[model samples]
Target chain A: MREFDLLAHVYRSNVDLPADVAIPPGDDMGAIRLGGQTLLVTVDQLADGVHVDLATASLEQVARKAVTRNLSDVAAMAARPVGAVVAVSLPRDFGDTRATELFDSMRRTAAAFDCPLVGGDIAMWDHPLLISVTVFAEPGEVEPVLRSGAQPGDGIYVTGRLGGSNETLPDHYTHHLDFMPRITLARELAGDAATRPSSMIDLSDGLARDLKHLCDAGNLDADLTIADLPLSDGAHQAARRTNEPAWQHALGDGEDYELLFTAPRSPRIETADVPITRIGTMRPCAGATPAILLHLPDGATCKLADLPSLGWEHHA
Target chain B: MREFDLLAHVYRSNVDLPADVAIPPGDDMGAIRLGGQTLLVTVDQLADGVHVDLATASLEQVARKAVTRNLSDVAAMAARPVGAVVAVSLPRDFGDTRATELFDSMRRTAAAFDCPLVGGDIAMWDHPLLISVTVFAEPGEVEPVLRSGAQPGDGIYVTGRLGGSNETLPDHYTHHLDFMPRITLARELAGDAATRPSSMIDLSDGLARDLKHLCDAGNLDADLTIADLPLSDGAHQAARRTNEPAWQHALGDGEDYELLFTAPRSPRIETADVPITRIGTMRPCAGATPAILLHLPDGATCKLADLPSLGWEHHA
Candidate 1:
């Protein structure tokens, strides 16, 4: 709700947009069709204390997180990363050596994803470090996915395990900082028009929150099966430490960076590593209150809207 | 030297670059040749207290400056602005009203340049306001000029007046916050191969510094006649207040946002408004000690390296 509201308010414009804009400002990546080619671009910013704690994160980790997160947005749109440009405003006291380290790390990570670091801007300022990476991508052979295509009877699926990405302590190594973006799996899922996802989203913010976004965009409702949701080992460990259910950690704690999507029928792809699991089904909109139902393995139903920190205030 | 040195160090990488990259990192913008079309991308950042004094300038002025500065880079390469994505990290105390105002201003400015604000990322942090704007552009009819293309015997020229853009007091109004980028003028100058500049650069860092960039990139030296350099009215005012020569201000005080370039022969285009003046001549590099010769109106010559702030240490 917060992201949607902010986006609507900030992107409200009076200018007439060009016809080449295939996708507008509020999507995961904006697409422009020019010269028989489609270019997809998305930007993500990582700030100290907000996205990463400099006390625990090395400049390399911070740089990696910044590049990977933007790549994740590209994956959500089922696009191939082409290039990236970064802009950094670093505290004046954050020495030149660390600055070089950060840029080198970003270049290395971007190359690992086949998205080379093309160019960037760096400035020394009296502020905590903030790095904004903008990635330019090209759409797949098939039309890229959007969040507004899910329909009733569509089966919902997610790639890999989720949760405790944030609750995983820095000392224990957090997936929130180092998890791989799902670009490869996205291509595998959306490679063919016949088997492509109806709608897709990356789990940057928790499953309940991101799934809620897809449902809101499509004006649909969803019923998720708690028994089918894959939980990470970090989620189990976190639940034990907090005296909460592991499933709760899997659904609430964010930054898994996995792919969540929907299709008419789940495609059992021959992927080697990442497991594709069907965990829910899209349903017709519940009209005025469009609810997200969470069916527990113990046969109890709870509203995802009722969960605490399902990412913003429910119904606000 | 500072910008170039930082660029070299920050852009050093160990990955194999794709051959499609026409212009690599360290230039004003990186160009990618994809699908028979060229895409030019450049990024810039504006920070609080560093680029603008919030005490004197409104958020609208800051946003305008941010968008126009990057547009200036596109102008330097004779590229047409197409789209832009901005990322902002605002302080926690900066209320929602201010955030909306800032975004709206950015959108408006971007639209004025025909570069629509296509997407962005926003965050709240405990830092001075920092905005990163990345622009996507396409080349003009001819090849976009590069700084390294300046050739010996080319005539040096500039679009519009320069200097005192920084010294102009905020109350009296400074051109630094409101200057129009030279995108249109660049098109007029580089519209044809016969008349186009051999090399080009935007004077964001003053004539002495930015012109030095063109010369350094091309392995050339230059000689400027003092009376031929067009001085802004603000430059004269600053010189009167500081007791320095007005030409000193024209040669040193930065942020003019004007275009300085070189061609084999000056193209006296039939254009109105912004005046184009031939101010100097490029020469073969001096090798061991390349010098920028300044011919004063008093029939005396001085090395540009001897000026107080020719940007960075003279011989360091």
Candidate 2:
């Protein structure tokens, strides 16, 4: 069975959603009322073989990736990070030298985001190295954004280039571990209530899959123009080497820790810090089968189901 | 490299503690300031083979153990439980039915503690099953009882019995996973300024090892009378079977999930809900060689270094 299927079953049947919980499972971050403030928390894991090739990747890269990936969820809700706690189980052969490096990297990366490493657990065992990071963040001046707020007329925008996260990495790295989490940009977008996003999510599981998440959450459909997809430099280079269109990689290549948000209109985004590309629009679902439609550069239209599932399948 | 040594290194050098963090790593739970409240959080994990024999243990037992272990930490701090989030990685052979049982057990246990399961992550892989639980709690009206507050003249008290956690279980089950987390009892003691505990910790790694934690955190020594140790019924039976002193098992067997605290004096403990035993007293350190000293029933005193280290050694 798929990982999401198991998680969805657990979320639907098992969890007892208390009244204090503002956001539930299946969101970027689950939030609860903490005294007078709202606290948003999320936990994510990166396994040695599943998320990265531990042989080639450094302990620092692995540590940074684990922290940054969780921070991406913090940014998705436009929440101000408080701090984080980490839990790691290292393989038997992993030495203390690498462990020291891992913790150092985690400290540095957390400090960079103004999120300190307050607590953690570490153990050595026979299993592959696994890192689980749980982050705590506070809602910004405005209410935190949810993925279920998108409307029929909202414009779909992305913060940075998509795809190529798997392409430009050096031999020692699996993906773009150095990429920023877009925390500041999301906060800026969230500061203004009129221009704030109706719904938002981080692109960790490809454009198509993540778009479907947004659509399903909002009960709407996504209509996108393939030509408008923001192709990263690494995406173009990989497309040339692999003899494929850059847009295909842009759509399917996951690990892009960029922001995909739906706004009422192009909300006066400046192209200084990060590029904001309007690639699509939200529409009312017309049929049961096709929830996501893409207009091709060759004057053709295709449903999301028709496209080859080239991105990473978590279970596959 | 022992597990404690690795953890001590991380606690000593790795974490970057900020002003907002009241309690750092190496405690039952770390505390941070959120708005006007102090939030105490902790995350702990249990692996299949390392913690339980998955071949004989049911998935429900595994799930319950993971959540209960974390709630015990909350009880140590006398914190009000807000909620908990769980992360699990399942082995390839684990079936969907078993997964359902695991989640349902986790939910029921969390709710019993008034800590609902708000979110979680589940994955399937080739490794043995691993479960990590992160719990969030807030301090009561009074400040949380810290491990560093033990005074030289304080009396050491323990709630419930200890030891023999390794015995009395069926071939498939673990030390009773149904034990309650002393949340209400700790909160009652914390609410009163006069009768509150000077320092506290939940018993997980045996009385000897965890007592060392309290001593090290407070920079003091503990003098315990062996005869006064509250031996569990399971401990008595197991000691009879193993031809060992019941007190030996009482002090060395881990996973008791009991509360051990140091108060100024025997503070009018109500022994109705749970048994309270005044085991010993805290004292000033006399020497550097032995931090924990045990007075035997025969009136002979010995240092902890002279003991055989019968407690659990985590990865060992």
Candidate 3:
């Protein structure tokens, strides 16, 4: 339905945002200053049938996905976790057992991330369970990273492999349900002044779309090497089943829940817990060229939108 | 329905809340201290056919209710707002024009309250629009007032009048649609050292139900004087239209966005913007008695649950 893109357009076009917004809507989180500090906040929603298949996944699985996806945004901002509140609209027929499981899982997963489930509102719907979780964070001892902070010639990098999440690898306890957020790595990088990212964004809406956000917000163009794209094993599985390239899955499958950021140099991988891949580099925007260009293995260059068969909402 | 009460039960019974939760779930807003300040957060949801009838209400009206109702929770905490984020799920047939109007209204309403709309998520549902709004606040120069802070023998006071909000006064732009949050009054009281409330809560789920929340959370009982209740003009109008008593309307018709609080003494009324009324006094809980007792003009005493024809969900 293009809801996400349309909402982004509305936020960018709407001119009446209050002067106090420290970090605006283009990034992984929005921030405001108060109590002599910066409070970074973001919210994400998971709807039955849209984000998860209720018949397949348990409430515990769904709860982790909802909480972790939001924590991924906090990772993008490189902010410390304050806490979170979850609001749920359950089916009227949703019995107490399922409700208890849902809240229990939500509380445990949030506590695991050190963002306790602080407060929430509950409502009953006739059908379709909806969970909206908001996380509040503070920029701890460092400036929060912004998507607009990218500079020309910065190295574009990402944590972990991407693709086949919420898709080919979808299962009760697989990729989509259990991928860890990049918060620990982000905090490590952001805590040290010299190693902080220039710009960062969480790859939720596929590498093609989310990378374009960084480029658009920073007024820069990215040249991504498709051969260097970190395709997950699930990407290869999806590619094998569909007769599509694994790289395509890496490029276009959304809900990867990985961090895509730019820094002067990639953080040292020897001390890191996850693999960091350099897939692209940024430059000043080409006059009228597309926001992203793919450098293929055979030395061919193509606009990201020129690729066909993106699953959903991938067009510019 | 009993969604609000059920949620309170879930939060209370579900143990293992992380140790850092500064102000826990029983309060109007859950709080945690970080970055040298206490961050208070709460969320509320509005759904079609539940909180609002989309056919009768504009998306703009829904947006304000979605934002201001959450702000009312912030006021209940006696906390200064930092910012807010709104997440919405639109029906597939929901046109772009209406979405634009909704965002515009949400932005304006939030900014007007000094709590800017900082970030949000968007989704599309098959039918029935849903809105979830989260607000973050900070206790400015004072400890946040908790629901469990009511001292026995304290005076229970309320700001503005109550009744006929979601029911008999269900006009397009009256009562429920347009009640200002008592954030200014809360700020005035909480900001000053001497006038802050002993305990506070927003009168949302009618006076009887909400007063019981203070009693249950504070381990006290309330003796409410019905004759002293500040019933709104709409309460009288609704009472005249139906055969119900005006005091019953004030006690049972929910969605009253007024502030209900307990203080040692009443805040000065002449300089206050809204009418402040002392309707009750708190006392120690007598072993197994009900949480609230109502005093009639003729000196007959009855439990709040003893009132017949309460319309909806008003019970211990």
> Across residues A4-104, which tens digit of lDDT does each residue of candidate 3 receive?
65667657754666676777665788888775778888898899888887898878899898899899999888887778889999998988878877887
Superior by lDDT: candidate 1 or candidate 2: 1
**Per-prediction backbone clash count:** 0, 0, 0
Off by over 4 Å in 3: A1-20, A167-173, A192-195, A314-316, B1-19, B167-173, B191-195, B314-316
Candidate 1 clash pair list:
none
- Flag regions of model 1 displaced more than 4 Å: A1-3, A169-171, A309-316, B1-3, B12-15, B169-171, B310-316
Q: Taking the tens digit of each residue's C-alpha lDDT, what string does model 1 give over A1-316?
A: 2445655776667346778887866778987766778888999899888888999877788999999999999999999988999888877788777777788889889999988788888787777888899999988475789988999999999988877786556456788887889998798778876569999999887888889889988999999999999998878888888888888877877788899999997678865388888999999987685678999989999888776654422211
- Per-residue lDDT of candidate 2, residues A1-316 (tens digit): 6666776776786445777887877799888888788888998888888777677667788889989999999999999888888888888788888887787788788888988777777766798988888899998586788888999989999987887786644443334676789888898898887669999999888888888999999989999999999998778877888788899888887888899999996876574378999999999988873298999999899988888766556432
The superposed Cα distance between candidate 1 and the true structure at residue A34, in angstroms, equals: 2.2
Candidate 2 structure lDDT? 0.82
Clash pairs, candidate 2, are: none
lDDT per residue for candidate 1 within B288-309, as digits (tens), equals 6556999999999988877666
Which RMSD does model 2 reach against the true structure? Answer: 2.2
Q: What is the lDDT for A67 in model 3?
A: 93
For candidate 3, give the lDDT of residue A21. 71
| Per-candidate interface DockQ score | 0.54, 0.57, 0.53
